[model samples]
Target: MSSEHFDVVVVGAGLSGIGAGYHLQTLCPDRSYVILEGRAQLGGTWDLFRYPGIRSDSDMYTLGYSFKPWTQAKAIADGPAILDYVTQTARENGIDRHIRYRQHVKSAAWSTDEARWTVQAEGPDGPVSYTCSFLFMCSGYYNYAAGHTPEFAGAADFGGRIVHPQHWPSDLDYAGKRVVVIGSGATAVTLVPELAKSAAHVTMLQRSPTYVVSRPSEDRFANWLRAKLPAKAAYGITRWKNVLFSMFFFNLARRKPEKVKERLLAMVRVHLGPDYDVGTHFTPRYNPWDQRLCLVPDADLFDALKSGAAEVVTDRIAHFTPGGILLEGGRELAADVVVTATGLELQLLSDVAFEVDGVPVDLASTYNYKGMMYSGVPNLAHSFGYTNASWTLKADLTCFYVCRLLNTLQKRGLRQTTPRIGAEALKPQPFLDFTSGYVTRAMEKFPKQGHRWPWKLYQNYAQDLVTLKYGSVDIEMEFSNPVPTHAQKRATADA
Candidate 1:
C-alpha cells in the first residue's frame, strides 16, 4: 500500500491527542497532521472503562485543556460526562476529521538519513503505513484490553459473576445483589458507593488501608467565577486556583507527612463519625503521598457506610468459597457478585516497538527528558501527566512545548532534535515514586530519571510550568539537519 505522509503523526485521539492536535494547528499552522486512534471511538480512558461510579479523581478545572473551559457544574464528573466533553472538544474544533479510528500502531522506525519516522499500523483494512517528520504518543499509561486482576486460590469455584472494572460486562446485572469489591484504590472507592445504591449490600474488601479524602462534588468558587467573568478568564482563574491548591497540598504532604496524615484522618473521622472504626479502614500504614489519596466526592462512600448500605473489610483473603470470600480468620462474607477493582496494568508507548536507524530502542536503558521525551529518541514526545495533579495540567505544557519545538525546527531548517545525556555523574531514580500497585508493578518496564535538572521528572506542576514553558531548549537537546538524499542532491546540481 502507498504510504500517507504528513508533517506530524499523533497516536490516540483522547484528551492528550486532541490537545496536541489543537496546539499543532494553532502554533504550527503550516504543518499537516493525523491522529491515529486504536479504538473506533474517541475518549480513550473515559470510553474504555464502564464500571459503576466511574469518574475523575481530580477536578475538571485543571483536567480540562488550557485552551478550553470546563463549564460543567460538577468539578468531579462522571465517565459519560467526561467523554462527552472530550468528544465535543474534538467536534467543535474540527479535529474529528483528522482522526483515523481503528488504526493500531504496531511499530515506528526512525530514519536519520531521511529525518522521518515510518509507522506501521493495523487498520480495519489491513497493514497500513504512514511517514511523518515528528511522532507524538498520547496513548495513556494503562492497558485498555485488561486490568490487574490477581488469581485467587479458587476463583473458578465461585458460581457468582466475577468482573474486572476494565472489562465490565454491559449486561451483567448486580441490582439487589450482594456485591463485594476487592481493592481500595480509586476504582474500588468509586464502585462501592455507586453499587451500594441498588445492590442489596456492597462491601469493599482490602488487604490494607488507603488514605481516602472527602471533597465537595461541586466547586462553588469555580461556579461563582464562571458566573461573574468571561468563560476563558473564569477558566484561567479556576485552573490557577486548583493548581496552587494541589501544589500546596502535595508539598505539605511531602514536607510534613505526619501532619498531613493526621489532617486527612481527621477529615475521614468527621465524615464517618466517632463511632465508626476509622483506624481500621481509612488509616494507612505508609506516610501520606506515598500513594495517591482516593478522592470520594461529597463523602459518598462514607455516606453509604453511615446508611448501612456498604461496609469495609480489611483482611487478607484465604480463599474463595462457593458463596463468598473466605477471610484468613475463616470468616465468610456473603457475596452474590465479585468486582475486582484491583488496579491498572501500565503499558508505556502503547507497547509499540521502536527503532532508530535499524537499532532497537531499549526504553529501560534510556533516561526520561523533561518527563515527555526519552534521552535517545529524536523528534518524538509522549504525554505523561502529573501523578499528583490533574493530568491535563502537565499534558497542556507538554503539547505546548512540542509545538514550540516543531516551530523551532521549521524556522532553523533542522530535521532532528534529540536529548543527549550530559557527562555529569547523575544518580538514576525510578521514573515514578508512587507506591501504588499499578506503578510498582510496571516500574522496571519504563525509563529512569536523573537526580538533576532536565533529566528529572518533577511531579510538581508549578516547577514544570516554569521549566517547560520558559526553560531553554538547548540545555541537553541536540539539533541537526539530515544529509541530503541522492535525488535531492542530483536535483540541486541539475538546477
Candidate 2:
C-alpha cells in the first residue's frame, strides 16, 4: 500500500493529542493532520485505568482545556465523567474522525534532505507507514502496558486474589470482603476510601507516609462565577484563580518547608482528631510538595477513618502468607483481596525509537528545549506538563507554542526547525526535580535539563505562560530550507 502523508502527525489521541489537534485546526487551518493512537480508544489514561475510585488529582477547572469550558458541578470528577468529557470534546471538534486507533508507532526516522518524518506503525492489518512534516508526541509519561509492582515474597502462596490497579479485573467481586491496598500515593488515597464502601474492612498498607489534603468536591467560587458570568468568562476566571493559588502554595511550601509541614499536619490532626496517632501514619519525613500531596474530596478518606471502615498501617511487608500479608513486627493483616496501587513506570516518547538520517537519536545525551522540544531534533515537539500544577496548564501553552512555530515555519517557507544548544558551561540536572519514587527511578532514562534559560524546564506556569505563549522561537532555534539533491534521490531509490 502507498504510504499516507500529512502535514502533521500526532502520536496519541488522549487529552494532549486532542487539544493539539484542535489548535492545529484553529490556528493553522491549511495544515493537514492525523492522530495515531496505540489503543483502540480516545481516552488515554482515563480509559486505561479502571480501578476503584479513579479520579483526577488536579481540579477540573485548570485540568480542562482553555478552549472548552468544563461545566460539571464536581471539580474532582470520576474517571467515567472525565472520559466522557474527553470523548465529547473530540466529537464536538470533529477531531475523532482523524484518529486511527490501534496504530502503535514503533519508530520514526527523520531525513534532513526531505525535512519530513517517515513513521512506521503496527496496526491490525500489520505494518503501516506514514510521512509527515511534523511529529507531535502526546503519549504521556508512563508505560501503558504495565505498572510498577515490587516482588513480594510468597506472592503465589496467597489464597486470595491480588490485582494491580493498572489492569484491574472488571469481573472480580469484593463486596463485604477484606481489602488491603498497598501504596500511599494518589491512587491508594483514592482507592482506600472508595473500596471501604463495600468491603468489610479496608486497610492502606504503606511503607512510608505521604502528605494528604482534603478539598471540597464542588467549587463554590466557580459555581458562583458561572451563575453571574458567561460560560467562557467563568471558566477563564476560575482557571486563573486556580492557577494563581497553585503557584502561591507551591512557592510557600518551598520557601517555608517547616511551616508548611506543620500546617499540613495540623490540618490532618483536625480531620483525624488528636486521639488518632497522626504522627505514625500521617507524618512524612520529607517536607510538603516533596512529592505531590494527595487530595481527598470533602475529607472522604478521613471520614472513612472516622467511621472505622478504613485504617492506615505504616509498616514494611515481610511476606505474603496464605491468609494475608505479614509485617516486619510479626503482625499479620487478613485480607480477601489485595490491590497494589503502586506507581507508574515512566516511558519517554512512548518508547518509540527515533532516528535522524539513519543514526539513532540518544535522548539522554540531549537537553530539553523550553520543556517542549528536544535539542537537535527537527520539527518535533513533546508535551510534558508541570509537576506542581495541573497538567493542562502547561499542555495548553505547549500546544499554543507548537501552533505558533508551525505558522512561523509556513510563513517563512522553512522546511525544518531544530534547537541547537550553545557552548555554555551549564550543569545538567534531572528532568524532574520531584522526589517521587517513579521520577527518581527513571531519572537516567529521561533527558537532562540545563541550569539556564530556554534549556531549563521551568515548573512555574507563570514563567512558562510568558515564555511559551509570547516568547520568540528564533532564539536557540535554527530554521532552514532543505532541498533534496539528485544524489540523495539516488541513495533513497537504492535503499
- RMSD for all candidates, in order, please: 1.4, 1.7
User: Over the stretch 139-169, how does candidate 1's per-residue lDDT look in tens digits?
Assistant: 9998888888998998889989899999999
Number of the top-ranking candidate, with lDDT as the measure: 2
Q: What is the per-residue lDDT of model 2 for residues 23-130, given as tens digits with 9 covering 90 to 100?
A: 999999999999999998998999999998999999999999999999999999999999999999999999999999999999999999899999999999999999
TM-score of every prediction relative to native: 0.98, 0.98
Of candidate 1, the 10-residue stretch with the lowest lDDT total is: 419-428
Worst 10 residues of 2 by lDDT: 421-430
